[model samples]
Target chain A: MAEIVLNALAHTYSRKPNAPQDYAIRQMNQVWEQGGAYALLGPSGCGKSTLLNIISGLLEPSDGEILFDGVKVNSLPPEERNIAQVFQFPVIYDTMTVFDNLAFPLRNMKTPAHLIQSKVHEIADILELSPLLHKKAKNLTADEKQKVSMGRGLVRDNVSAILFDEPLTVIDPQLKWKLRRKLKQIHDQFNITMIYVTHDQLEAATFADKIAVMYEGQIVQFGSPHELFENPKHTFVGYFIGSPGMNFMNVQLEEQHFVFEDMKLKVPEKILDKIQHLPYESIKLGIRPEFVHVWDKKNDEAYEVDVIDSEDLGTYHIMTFKLRNQLLKARLHEDQRIPKHKAWISFPDQWLKVYVNEYLVEADDE
Target chain B: MNKIENNKAWFLVLPVFVLVAFSAIIPLMTVVNYSVQDVFDTNTRYFVGTEWFKAILNDAALQSALMKQFMFSFTTLSIEIPLGIGIALLMPKRGMAASLCLVLIALPLLIPLNVVGTIWQIFTRSDIGLMGWSLREMGVAYNISRNPVDAWATIILMDVWHWTPLIALLCYSGLRSIPEAYYQAARIDRASRWAIFRYIQLPKLTNVLIIGILLRFMDSFMIYAEPFVLTGGGPGSSTTFLSQALTTMAIGQFDVGPAAAFSIIYFLIILAVSWVFYTTIMNMQKEK
Candidate 1:
């Protein structure tokens, strides 16, 4: 186990990346401390898998230095790097028994039969696959096959890190939870540095200590789940993380205040000062759907909007309101009163996030 | 919950049934009829009651031919399977090169068996042929007509040259069907090249290999044309296989009853061996 550092890592499928879009993974530097669990989180085709493959040495970065324990391993093969990767679909040797499948890596290193047996038994017991030891890997169900793949990774003691590229994509929803918990338990037990790649925010939040949010082939933000929720470093993160996500409204700094359409949104003085200095022409105001307080009366600091649609989502309600052709969503709790066609809404100053050119501008916390 | 009996569907199957009966059953019955009786003429025949089968089984020339047939089939399979896999592995996977290699490798298979034998016959002539002249230039005695060993070697090589491409093409398709994820996983597992072959490539090729083996075994066991054209059962019947023996008995010698029995035996052997290969390979897959 070793700390993994990617220094200005970039990958381009094309020999000559003429434009920024040509790069599958744009230039970025990141680090994973030894034994840290990180989720490379993004939507599909956002380069999470590309980054994961680069880290596992499955795909060498077109440019960059990958250092393990401060030693350059950029040119190392996956085998030499001692990295294990579990793919989106379960990959198992179809002709081998589950025991042999689990014993594969150890046997590859020519480990003695007795040692392999013990290791196989241990991993099988941990994965609850002891009963399936004699069964062919091809005969197992999807999750069981996935467990076998994981067992192959876990069988080897010298593996520096285990990279998972959306390993749960094919598993059923019921089994996804159990398998994810099993993976978490295995991480705690093995203390191997694990990087889990996924597009599901819930899976990322539940499985990883830190979630690296990727957008457009770049890691826009890296932080703990709580930090990502409270203060997303990029507007994409704010829009991607939560249920219904954070609602963003296009705004312009005019004269002294921020104007969204004809409504002048009230912002904290410190934020207003930062907004004045923002060099971008386009500005946006972001707030989580939960933070937009809906009111029955047209109170001070409240802006009037027409309710377009309201969905009753069991425990809470998500009400979509239109303010001068701009749609805004406010999540209301079960006890909160449902508004009529016309409703007055206000985004609390504490939850107000200012964005310049889609990147978060530091907001003053209440 | 009553089930409907579809008696009308039988009418729909009548056309195919009649076609199969005319094309297959009638000829097969004629062969059976010939096998069971000794016919002096169409009107006068004696019911032999397995006498022809017994006589043909005891025939030493037919026995030797059967042995030769088995030897040829087994030897060709053993050589071709691994050689085909190797060639397939070396074949380019995609793009223009792959297409070119496929066309080139398949060229030999497309030629008629007789033409292939004739081409090799002229090509192996020491006086005028490239391969034979090259061997002669190298001072090695390589004559197909003069020595049994040389004839057998040449026949086997000709068969390899003609049919190994079929196996290789099947294996190429099999290898192409395998997803890239398996290789990636193997690499991550630190699998040796041999281990990758043994575990990933070999197991994935099982289905296609079974088809290749079955087709090759049946086709080789019924070998007639190529050897007939090239060797002509030459150098003391060294290459006279089952089909040639059956041909001699039925056509050359005019022993209808015995030839019909031998034909049944040959058909049974091919059927039995094909069944065995199919069941054994399929069972191996299911068991594992």
Candidate 2:
């Protein structure tokens, strides 16, 4: 296994990318440490697959260098790179038995027959496919076919990394969890660098130690799941990573105070002191719906808002509110009372994050 | 769930049944009637009771024609299947060049069968044809009308030129239907080029290859028009095929009893061979 490093890697489908939209993958520089489980998380068409393809050497980057273990391998083809990839759809040789499908890579390398058998048996046992060894690959279920695809990767002797591009999209929901657990078990046993790409946050959080959030062909934030939920580096990350997402409102900074329409919000003294040194005019305040505390009585630092709608989601109620012309959502517990027309909500100081130009801004920053 | 049982839906199928009967079954019954009788004329006929069938089976001319017919079908299929696959492999995968190559390859398939024969007849003529005149100028004696080898070669070449495109087109569509991910996965698996072809491309092309082979076999077995126009079964009976012999007996000589028996035998051979091809290929796929 090797530590994969992307040094200023960028790719564009067009020969000449005159604008940012023309680029499928904007410039990126990141390192995937050896034996680390990482997730490249994004919505559809946000260049996650393009990035995965580039990393696997399926698509050469337009401008950059890829280094495996600090060796420049930018011009190397996928076969020479020793990188295995599982695709979104299950890909298996339909005419081959499941045993032969798992033995394919080893057989291609001209490995001895006995060695190939052992490797095949090992992977099949791990994937719970031992009983299907002699069956034709085409007759298997969708998830079993996917298991064979992954088994092809695991059967190899020297794969530097295994890249997965939403490998669970075709699997039944109940089977997806079992397959994901198998993947984790494989990662623990093999100790190879694994990069999983997906749009589902739960899948990413459950699989990878670190999640790289991509938006508009750029990785806006890379951190653990806890960090992504608590202190998002970009507004997109905050909005993308949560169930209800972080609620953000456009605010203006006036004489060391934050103003949103007619509601005035109090800022901490340290944040207020740092506000004078802000570099941008556009400002926003963000807080997770789970952190928005609602009260029926007027309390200190509370603002009144009209309740537009409320939905009881069994475990929690998602209450929608309107302040001036902006809509806000708050999540309440099952035992919590639902206020009538008007409700007072409080944004805790620690939970409130300030954004300057759609990027997170720290109070301690210069 | 309760099942709905209704007999009225059969009325919708009656139209197709009537069409099949009028087009196929009725004509076949007439042939059966003729095969079992000695028809001297419409008014004068006698029951032959398989006499014509036994005589036609023992006829030396019909036996040789049947041999020639099998040889021709086998020769053309052996040449065209490999040649068409090669052309498909060399063809471009995408963009304007792929479209241009497709159109060029499909040009000969659009030509009428009789027109193709006439074109080749002129093309192989010694007097005014480009290929024939050039071969003579190069000191090669090539005359389809006189020499059996030259006649056989020319007919095979003509059949190849006229029908190789059908196999190529079927194979091209089959190749296009394979998703791009298979190739990528093969590359990542470090499979050799030949390995990719053997496991991926060849397996995926199995269905189309079956269709191509069976179509070529059945068509070439019943081949007429082209060879009839080109050689007129010339020099000797060397190039006379089963269809030409059947045509001479039925239409030229008006031997309706023997011709009807020969037609039934021809239909049975085609049906048996096609069924064999289909079942063998399908079983091979399942076994793998």
Candidate 3:
């Protein structure tokens, strides 16, 4: 296994692309540490697959050198790179038995027959496909075929990494957890650098120790799920990384206080100090719904707004309330009283975030 | 839930049955009628009862022609199927080049059979034809007449040139339907080019190849025009296929009874062989 690095990597489907919008992957540099589980998370059409293909050497980057273990491998094909990829859909040899499907990579390496047999058996056992070893891969279910596809990746001995391109998309929801757990177990066992690309935040968060949140062909933030939820590096990250996402609204500085359409939010001096020089129209205030506290109405520091709606979700409720002319969300615990017409909510200074020009302005005592 | 039974649905299908009766059933019945009767005229006829069938089956000339027919069909299939697949694999997947390739491959298939026969006849003639002239210049005695082996070779070559495109087109469509993920996975697996073809491409091609094999087999088995135009069963009747023999008997000699029996046997052979082959290949797929 080796650390993967993308050096000034960029890609454009057009031969003479001149505009940034023409790029499928914009110029950027990143490193994936050896033996680390990482997720490249993004929405559909945000170049997640394009980036994954570049990593696996399926698509050559229009600009950049991809280094494996500090060796420039920009021209090497996937076969020479020793990278294995499991695609979005199951891609196993249909005419082969599950055993042969799993054994394919090993056989390709000209590995001994006995070793291939044991390796395939080990992988099949891990994938819960031992019973189907003799059955044709085409005869198996979609999920089973996907497992066989993954099993092939696991069968090889010298693979530098395994890339998964939304490998769980076609799986039944119940089996998703099982397969993810199996992937975790394999990561622990093999210590291969696994880069899983997906659009689902839950899938990414659970699978990777760190996730690179992509927006418009660039990775806007790369951090742990907790860091992403608490301190999003970009407005898009705040808008993408959590359930119901973070609450954000444009803010204007009026002498000392941050104001938005007569509604005011108390901004920390440190946050204000960093964003003071930025353009006024570019300023934005953000806070996660979980951090928006619903307090007692008798408290004067809290803003009491009329409740627009509250969606009951078993263990918690998402309370939407109107403050002056702006609506905001606050996640409330199941044990908390469900406010009917009005709710008093307060934004904590520590949880509040400042943004200038769509990127987070860090004001923490770092 | 109680199912709603509607007999009126079959009324919607009555047209198809009527069409089949007029197109296939009545014509086949007439052939059967002629096969079992000795008829000088419509009014003067006698029940022959297997007499024509026995004569057709036992005739040494017809038996040799049947053997030649099998050889021709088998040769053409063996050459065309692999060649078509090869051409398809070499073809580009998409773009202007791919579209151009598709149009050119489809050109041969769009030609009428009669025109194709005429084209090949003149094209392979010993004197005036390009192929014939080129071969003569190269010191190879290439004549579709006067030499049995040369006639057989020319006819087989012409059949391949005319018909291989159908197989290629079918294979190209089949290859296109396979997702790009397969090739990606194959590459990631470090599969050799041969391995990719053997395990991935070939397996995916089985369905289309079955169609290719069946269509080519039937057409080549019943081949008449091209060879009839090129050689006319010449060179001591060495290349006289079953259809030519049947044509001589039915039209030239006016032996309608024997020709009818021969036609029935020919139809049965094609049907039985195609069914057996299709089932065998399908079962092989299932086992895999």
Candidate 4:
């Protein structure tokens, strides 16, 4: 395994690609450590796959230097990079037996016959595909075909890394969990550097050691799942990471107090001072749905809210309300009783975040 | 609501069956009748009991034509299949270039069979055609109208030019049907260009290639119009294929009994060969 470094990486497909806006991927500087399981996670058209392709040597960055183990590899082809990939759909030689499909790369590399059989058997056993060894790949079911595709990547031990691009999208929902867990097991056993690309947050959270959340052709945040969930640096991160994502309500800061509609709430003095000098006309208070506590009546710590609707989701209730005419969601315990017409909630100052123009503003200690 | 049952669907196929019966079944029965009889015109017919079959079985002319047909089919298949695939591989996958390539390839297929023959007839003449004049200027002694070797080369080249694009277009559609993710996976596997073609592209192309081979075989075996027009079975009958021989017996000699017998045998040969090709390809595909 080798540490891969991307230095000032940017790509543009046009002939005259000098302008900053012409680039699909802007200048990105990052290091993917050896033997780490990383994921490039983003919505469609977000350039996550582009970044993965560039790293695999399938695409050359218009301006950048990529180094593998401190050796320049930007000019290398995929064959020279020594990496394996599993696609969203299984790509197997349909005319060959399942065994042949797995053994093809080894055969191309001129591995000895005995070693090829042993390696094929080893991977087949791990993937639980021993029963399909003699069958033609085209005759297999979709999941079986996908297992063959995965085995082709896993059977080789000499590769530097394995890249997966939404490899489970075609899998049945019931089988996705099993395959994902199996992949994690394989990674743990092999300790190979793996980079997976997907738009599914749950898949990225469950699979990768480090998740790089991308948006609009840029890496919005690169951190552990916990870090991304707890302390999102950008507004898009807050809006994207959760199921019922974080809520952002506009507020006005005056001294150590913040005003929302007719209500004034006290904030920490330092946070108030940090925002006082900003030119923005409004500040945003961001909080996750689970962190907001709903109350039955007005209290010193609570803000008045007009309840709109409540949806019971078996394990929890998703309560929707209007604060200063802006929609907000609050997750409450399943058994908790909430009043229909009116409700009050407390935005715990400790969990509350302040933002100015999508960038997080410093919070002051009161 | 209950699902609608359409038992009357058979009515929709009745006309097709009648048309096929009139066009295929009646002629087949007539050929079978002639195969077993001796006829001296519409006035007299006699039961001959497979005498013509025995004669055809031993005839040297029949044997030579059969060998020629086999060579033609095999050569055409070998040249067309790979050339088509190579051209298709080089074609742009999408956009204006794809449409342009498609139109250019399809142009030859849309030309009438007789027109293709007439066009090549003039195109290969030593005095007027660009190809013939260029060959002469390059110091090559070439004349399709007089030389057997030139005749064979010209016919083969014409067939290749007319039909290779069909196979290529079919293979092109097959290649396009593949998801981009597969290519990505191949790249990730660090598969060499040869490995990618052998393992991924070729296997994916099997179904279309089968169609291409069968179609090309059937078309090449029945070839008559172009060679008949260009060579006119000349240079001592070097290019007189099975179809031309059958037509000579039926139309030129008016030997109905022998011609009918030959037609039946010719039809069966094509059917049997096509069956073998289909079965072998399908079986190979199944093994994978």
Candidate 5:
């Protein structure tokens, strides 16, 4: 397996992409270490598939170079690039038996007859498709068909990476969990670089070792799931990851206090110093809904807000409140007292994030 | 629950009854009546008791003509199916060029049957037509009337030119319905071009090809107007087909009794052949 590197890669569907809007994938760079489980996570139509296609060599990038193990692979076809891709929908040869479907890649490579047979059996056993090997692929259920498709890729040993593009969209919710666990097992067993692309944050977080948060055709932040939740580098990530997501309020810096619409809050010296180095234009303050501490009584550092709406979501409650006319969300535990119409909230220093131009500013050295 | 036997539902089916009667049963009954009768006039007809049917079945010329018709249909099918698939495979998948090509290929299919006959009739003229004149200039001796081989070749070529596009268009739509992901997966699997076609394209195209084959077979089997216009049972009745023979007996010579029997036999042949083809293809699908 090779370490995949996308060096300043960009792509566009137009013949001449003169404007930035014309590009489907804007110029960016990313690297996936060998055997790393990475998820390229984004909303629908955010170029997650485009990036995956490029990495799989199905679609060549308009600009920049793709290196595998530090060697350029721009001129290589997908077959020569040694990459396998599983698509959003299961793709299998309908006329063939499940055994033949799994054996396809090895047969294509002209592996010896006995090796092909043994490899097919191995992959079929791993996918739990040994019993259905004699059955036609067309007759299988959606998840079984998906496993067969994935098994086609796994049958070959020469592949450098396996790219999955929303492979669970067609599967029912009940089966998705089992299939995902199977994928995790496969990853652990084979130690090959796997890049999973999806719009569901839960799928990304649960399956990937490192989740790359993509926004507007760019990878905004790449880190572990815990890191992405603890610190979303971009405002989009903050708004995307959690249940109600992180609440963001546009603020202006004035006299060491962050001022918003009809509201003001003092900042610590270290955070203020970091904010000073960043441009004062387009400043925003962000905090996760889980971290916004709601209080029944007014504290010294608390800002009182009207509790506009609160949803009882079984275990916890998501309370939407207005802070100085700006709406915000906070997650409260089940045992916490429910505020009627008014609640005092405090943005704790540790949870508060100062954003300059929609990008998070480090309040302290890591 | 009480079971009520109501006779009123039959009235609700009157439209279908009248439709089936007018469209099928009436005409078929008339043919059967003619097949079994010796009718000098509508008022003076006698029950002949299968005499005409026996006579028609025993006709040697008509038997040869049926054989000739089968040959024509078989040849045209064998040529058109593979050629159509090849053309579909080679066709551009999208954009302005694809649109232009589709329209051009469909042009001949829209032409009236007689018009197609007239076009090919003139187009293959040895003296003036583009192709015929070119062949004559190239020192090739080609005359559709005097030579049986030339006549057969011309009719087959004309039929291929007129009908290959229908199959091609069906196959093109079928090929387009296949997801792009299949091809991408094949590429990643390192499949050869032939392997992709064999396992992917051909399997996906099975239903469309079945429909195309049955359609072409039935249409070619019943073909009349084009060949009739071009040849008119020419030279020595060498190109006479089942429909042409029936038309000559019923309309040309007013041999209604034998011609009615002939038409019924022709209809049965088409039905039986199409059913056989459909069932065979379906069984193949099931076995796979």
Candidate 6:
């Protein structure tokens, strides 16, 4: 395990980094601590994989330095980085037997033959791949081939980190869960620094100790899965992390009152004073589907809604409604029923989030 | 699943099958008919039951030509496959450069085969040709038309120049088909460049290499036009490969029956050799 420090690291594919948009990855300042299970999560083409590649030393950054355990490694190649990586698809040597595929890196490093055998057997056992060890790798099932890919990476004990790049995308859903669990177990047992890159929220939430949410080549937020869910730092995060993500309604803020369309809702005295000094004309209110409560019209704080659609998802229902021309989704308990024509919804004060120009506006100090 | 209801799809392939059968089957029937007969003139002919086959088998010249053909094919394949793969590795993976390399490499293949032979014949001449002049200026006695060593060298070099690009192009396509993710996986494994090439790139190229080898072997074994035009199978028959020998027997000596029998033997040898190469590669792939 090693502490990885990215010091103003940036990359540009072009010769001249003349424009801001020309950079594939902007200056990134981060410190991923030793033994931490980190995830770089984002949509496609967001520089997540690029960042992973830079760290792995497959690509050189245009500027700045990367330090692993306080030693500068920006000039090091991948072989010198001492990291293991599992790719999106299995990259096993199809001509080699499963045992040989797993044992290749060890053999390349000139590890003793007996030790290679024992270590391969150990990883095969952990991955439940011992029975198929004698078989050629090409004949294995997709899931089994993926296990061989994983085993190849895992067999090396001296690797400073293990990187997984959407490794489960090709795997069947059933096998993905088992592999995720197995990866988690390996991480726990070995305590190596692991960085997993994926676009899937569930996989990110399940495997990562800290999730670094990336959008448009920048890390928007880096925190635990719960922090991302409860307090998204950017609007992209709010819309990206949850199943039915947080809904945003544009509001006009004046002096001490917030107006949503024609309805002026009194703001909490503290939040009102903080935004008064900012020069933003509009404030957006964000609330998760689980936080929006649908209630009777007689409820004092409830705002009126026109139900758009309702999808029954076995355990719960996702009820989509419109409030002042903005679409909003609400999650209701299995037994809860609401009229399709009109409904009243209310946001709990604690769960209400405010954003100014796509950036999260922190709550005011009391 | 029920049988696919797309009957119209068969129309897309009908023209191809029809063209292939017309070109392939008719010529094959002609060859088969010629193989079993002796033609004395336009009208006089006799059915020779395996007499020509026995004569061809016993012919010392035919046996030597077969040996020379195998050696030429083997040498050409040995030189071209690795050279092609090396050039392919040096090629850029993307952008205009990759396209440029592809176009340049494909130029030779696009040229008519006889034209390639004619061009090389002039290019390797001792007096006026640039290659010959340069070699002479560099203090080497090089005359392809009269010297067996020079003739052999010129032919091998020409074969390499003409066909190495094909292997390289096939290898390039195979290399390009590999996803970037595989390289990422290699990097994470901390694999050396050689290890990655051996384990990942080489195995990935095996299928294409098999095809490349078979095509190159068939072409080189049957090579007649280029060497015939350049050296005229002279320099003392050193470059007289099987196809040249067959041409000499049929056209030069006009022994139609023996030549017909020789061609059948030649075709069978190619078929048997190609089958061996294909089966060996497929079996190796299966074992993996």
Q: Score the docking of each candidate (DockQ).
A: 0.77, 0.74, 0.74, 0.56, 0.78, 0.57
Candidate 5, residues B33-68: lDDT per residue as tens digits? 899888788698888988987887888998899899
**Please, what are the lDDT tens digits per residue for candidate 4 over residues A1-366?**
778898888887788977767778888888888889888888898888788888888888888899989898987987788888777777887778999989987887788999999999999999999988998888888888888988988887767788888989989999999999998998898988889999998999999999988887778789999978877777778888987889997888766777777878777777766777789855878998988988867787777778899998889989999887789999999878865868889888767888787767766342
lDDT tens digits, residue span A1-366, model 6: 678899999998999779878888998899988889989999999999999889988899999899999999999987788877777878888778999999988987889999999999999999999999999998998889988998887888767888888989999899899989999998898898999999999999999999999988789999999999999989899999998999998888865778887888778776776777888855888999999988956477888789999999999999999998888999998988755779999999888888888888876562
Decoy 5 TM-score against native: 0.98
- Strongest candidate by TM-score: 5
Tell the DockQ for candidate 3: 0.74
For residues A116-171, write the lDDT of model 2, one tens digit per residue: 98989988999999999999999999999999999999998879999999999999
Regarding TM-score, does 2 or 5 come out ahead?
A: 5
Best by DockQ: 5
Provide the fnat value for model 4, as a fraction from 0 to 1.
0.61
Tens-place lDDT digits, model 2, residues B158-201: 99999999999899999999999999999999889898889999
lDDT of 1 by residue, A1-366 (tens): 989999999999998789999999999999999999999999999999888888888888999889999999988889999988999999999988999999998988899999999999999999999999999899999999999999999999868999999999999999999999999999999899999999999999999999999999999999999989988778999999999998888987877677877777656677777767658967888999988989879998788889999999999999999988888899999998899899999877768888889988775564
Name the runs in model 1 displaced over 4 angstroms. Answer: A275-277, A363-366, B1-9
Clashing pairs in 4: A136-B288, A271-A364
For model 2 the TM-score comes to 0.96
Q: Considering summed lDDT, which 10 consecutive residues are worst modelled in model 2 chain B?
A: B279-288
lDDT of 3 by residue, B33-136 (tens): 99999889869888999999999999999999999999999998999999999999999998999999999988988888778878888887768988888889
Error of 5 at A313 (Å): 0.8
- State model 6's lDDT: 0.88
Instruction: Give the Cα error of residue B265 in candidate 6, in Å.
Output: 1.2
Candidate 3, CAPRI quality class derived from DockQ: medium
The pairs that clash in candidate 6 are: none
On TM-score, who's better, 1 or 6?
A: 1
DockQ of 2: 0.74
